[model samples]
Target: MTRIVLLGGGVGGSMVSNQLARQLKPEILRGEVEITVINESDTHVYQPYFLYMAFDQAVPADAKRPERAVLNNQIKLVVGHAERVDREAKDVVMGDGAHIPYDYLVIATGSRPAPETVPGLVEGGHIFYTEEGALKLRDALAEFTGGRVLVTVGVPHKCPVAPVEFTLMVRDWLDTHGFESSEVLYTYPIGRLHSLEPVAAWATEIFDQRRIDSRTFFNVETVDSEKKTVTTLEGDTVSYDLLVAIPPHLGQDIVKRSGLGDAGNWIATDRHSLLMQGTDNIYVLGDATNLPISKAGSTAHFQADVVSSNLVNRIHGGLGSVRYDGKVFCFIEAGNDEATYVKFDYQHPPKPQPPTEMIHLYKLAFNKMYWLSAAGIL
Candidate 1:
């Protein structure tokens, strides 16, 4: 039997496994193939909702579902932490010392925020990346009256557009929640408001129109919790009554332990094939790859199509000629119930459209329809 093992239960892994199961239903029924997903958690959380959760617009229940429910019944689900991937032996070593062998491997372990890397950041600033972080930020917002709200961004974080969306939404929130006196100051590590040139230009226009203050080339060095201030590597200190930070992210520890990734734990992957470099049977996707692209859910969904098709074709003695075109789409919330969207591929740059209430409503609908997406029906 051809055994395929997926080493994570995130969006990419779940989608690919489900797609493969659907496409290879005949092979599986004949005892020709098997698919297994090894994940550390029994629950699958839609992380995008954490942004809304911080603003009290969503709850934890809105973001979470049983991992088994999100996956296909035919796929085996293993809930345990992985120790390391044994590439030479072609198996995954579990923390409990179990060896799961595979004819093919898919690494989708995703990424994690490293707030502790920045001194005093864990104690001084608020982050909405995780469920706990979002709930804490929600409590902080509830108690806040009015002050200088600073939003500092770090490099290589997931959900590239979240910081911008949060800034815009918070500005509107302050106005509607009797905190109109609050000042919002945004900062970026690079020399622009955003990494994408077009996005930077678009966000700059919105910031100016909304009277939001911003600074570029501000690399956070440390935070002084007692003083309520942040110091930048450029030798400048800024005071804030409240601080929201998008912390730097790194790949899974198992990737590093297995020596399958760089110092930052990002695995080298073929852009078109989505396969790990120097390997034919191993594929990498989502935030695990070092590809120079936004680590967003849409990217994972797009890559899933390529990987699943290739895997299915290869199992049928095909050359697996399908290639990923680096397609990505993102909804940019512009506040006041208006939103915009940007769609681009490897050869094209995104041009964000004008904000509209209809687009905002579509984004809300998409949130509710995300379960269908996870089920590989959309």
Candidate 2:
């Protein structure tokens, strides 16, 4: 029997496993193939919902579901932490010392925020990356009356547009709560409000209309919690009454420890084929790969389709012909009631669509569609 093991049951892993199960049903039923998924937690979170959850627009329960509830029954689910990959022996070592062997391996362990990398960042800043962090920020925002609200972007973070979304949402929240004295400010390492040229132009116009102060090229060096200040590497300092920071992100420790990661600690893979560099039977997807795309769930959704098709080809002794074109789409929220859509690929950069209430409705509808995706129905 051929054994296939998928690491990290995130969006990429779950989607690929679901597709493989359907495509290889005959082999699975005949007991000629086996599929197993290893994950650290039983819950799967719809991370996009975290933004709405922070502002009391969405319930925390709506953002997550049991992992097993979303995966296909034909696939095996192993709940454990992956320690390391023994590529030479073709085994995955678990934290509890179980060695799972595999004829083929899939790595989808996503990236995570590392706040500790910046001194005092954890203590000084409010973050909304995790469910807990979002809830905490919700409470903090609720108690805020009038002060300087600062949002900073740490380099190479997930959800490239999230910090901007949060700033706009928070600005609206302050206005609605009658905190007219509250000043909303934004800072980024890059020279523009957004990495995409067209989106940045649109965002800059919006920032100007909203009177939101923005400064670019501000690379964060450290945060002084006691003084309520953030210092850049160039020695520029900004003080804040309440700071919201997107912390530095890194790949899973196991990937780095196994020597499968690049110098930045992200897994190296062919941008087109999604195959891990220097390995034939191993593939990568999602935020784990060092691909030049936004580390958003939409990117993972598109990549999952490419990876699934390529994986099936390999299983049948055929070369993977599918090539991912770096396509990504995102719904950028301007405020509580309006949003804009942006779709692009590597060759074609993002062009902003006019912000509308309809797109906001679409974003809401996507939360419902997410479950269908998890169930492999869409």
**Maximum-TM-score candidate:** 1
List model 1 lDDT by residue over 84-135, tens digit each: 9999999999999999999999999999999999999999999999999999
| RMSD value for candidate 2 | 1.1
* Tens digits of per-residue lDDT for model 2, 246-356: 998998899988899976679989888888988878989889999878888888888889887987887787897899999999889998588998899989999887789
lDDT of 1: 0.94
Residue 132, model 1: Cα distance from true site in angstroms: 0.4
* Candidate 1, superposed: residue stretches over 4 Å from native: none
lDDT at 132, model 1: 100
Model 1: lDDT of residue 308: 96
State how far residue 191 of model 1 sits from its true place (Å): 1.0
The numbered model that scores best in lDDT is 1
